[model samples]
Target: MTTHVQLHDRLDYQSVAPLMAELTAIADDMLVIDAGNVRHLGTLPLQVLLSAVRTRAAQGKITRLAHASDNCIDMLGLFGFTPETLTQPEAWT
Candidate 1:
């Protein structure tokens, strides 16, 4: 089952351990992590996202992020995450 992750709070530079865990559960399915309303972005969030995506990808399943903010894009680049709109693009802002 594909799950849509809509984010509205601080995603960057914040500990997403709790969020990560929740996302992990749907790792086996198509996941959409929405960050359209996010304002702050940081490396930690990027790390968590990458890690989660990688983990899910390895299982033949993948995670996707959408509606990312500019800050999200910067963080993705800063963390070396390539251009994947749903994964690291600021479509929302």
Candidate 2:
């Protein structure tokens, strides 16, 4: 089953650790992260997301992003992540 994770509006450095912990708990399942309400994006949270992706991949699972706001998309792009890369099932490996 796929679990939908609703991300917070502001994903700054302070929020990364908690988010990472939460995501890590569910890393064994397929995750679809909803970013529609994200108004801010920070590098720390981006790293958390990347780590979640890798964790899921290690378990032969997948993590995908959905409803990403322009800010989220732009920030991810700045970090060299495209929409396709974020959602591609094969990208994790």
Candidate 3:
């Protein structure tokens, strides 16, 4: 089954632990991350997302991002990532 995870508006350092825990809980399932509300994508949260993507890929599950906001897209771009690129596990490596 595909599980949808909705990202917070402020994905800063404070959100890392909670986000990681949420993602980890769904590690065995196909994931679709909803990024439409994301206003700030901090490095730590980005790392958490990357880790989740890699883990899902290794387990032969899919991880995708959906409905990304413009700010979220820009923030990802600053780190050389797009919502599409984020889903590719190889990109993280």
- lDDT of candidates 1 onward, in order: 0.65, 0.82, 0.92
- Position 82, candidate 3: lDDT: 92
Say which candidate scores most in TM-score.
3
lDDT of 3 at 56: 81
- Residues 1-93 of candidate 1: C-alpha lDDT, one tens digit per residue: 878877756764445776677776773468877877666666666667666766677677756767777766666566565438435333313
- Model 2 misplacement above 4 A: 87-93
lDDT of 2 by residue, 1-93 (tens): 888989999999999889988898883468899999988889888888887787687788877889999988898888778756975536545
* Residues forming the 10-long window of minimal summed lDDT in candidate 2: 84-93
Positional deviation of 54 in candidate 3, in angstroms?
Answer: 0.4
Q: Estimated TM-score per prediction?
A: 0.72, 0.87, 0.94
Stretches off by above 4 angstroms in model 1 are: 12-14, 82-93
Report residue 87 deviation for candidate 1 (angstroms): 4.9
Error of 2 at 77 (Å): 1.0
List pairs with backbone clashes in candidate 2: none
Tell me model 1's lDDT, rounded to 2 decimals.
Answer: 0.65
The alpha-carbon deviation from the true structure for residue 92 of candidate 3, after best TM-score superposition, in angstroms, is 3.9
For model 3, the stretches where C-alpha displacement exceeds 4 angstroms are none
